[model samples]
Target: MIWEIVLFVSILYLINIVLLTIIVFKGPTIGDQVLAIDGITYGSIVLLILFSVYFKEPILTVVAIPLALWVYALDIYVSKYLERGDLGA
Candidate 1:
């Protein structure tokens, strides 16, 4: 039962990755590409958490928090750069 759930979630994550890759490469605009990259980062975070559960290693789960924070920072930095053409305000 639990194994089935894990398999299902893993499949979904793979599908998400494929779709995001398509969007990242063929998006109509830079904003669309950036959004797709952000989506990929979030999907990676979810995968990390899922892997931690499947492996029964609580310590592995700790990595996802910092990864999430880093992705958030990246989104902010990119948005700022796009809006102002500079990273520094």
Candidate 2:
């Protein structure tokens, strides 16, 4: 049933979270940690949408999109900072 699918996806997401958590804490370098945080952000976004679908909550869907975008913007800013010395011209 639909619950089975949701359960499966939730388990996978949980595993992803665990791995990302380890990388975020013990990653060898800053770039690796940043990428791991990005992955965690994206995974949480997907998990949010999935739960919204399961619960039939439109508000959660609405919330997830903006959070995802914000995470994306932060990721870009961080990557730029990592690549270049400054965020300004």
In model 1, the Cα lDDT at residue 22 comes to: 98
Candidate achieving the largest lDDT: 1
Q: What is the C-alpha lDDT of each candidate?
A: 0.86, 0.85
Judge candidate 2 against the unseen true structure and give its global Cα lDDT, from 0 to 1. Answer: 0.85
Q: What TM-scores do the predictions have?
A: 0.88, 0.86
Task: Give the Cα error of residue 71 in candidate 1, in Å.
Answer: 1.4
lDDT of 2 by residue, 1-89 (tens): 89789868977997998999999899899888878888998888888888988888877788777877887898888878978968984
Q: Which residue pairs come into collision in candidate 2?
A: none
* Per-candidate clashes, comma-separated: 0, 0
Give residue 58's error in model 2 in angstroms: 2.1
Summing lDDT over every window of 10 consecutive residues in candidate 1, give the lowest-scoring window: 2-11
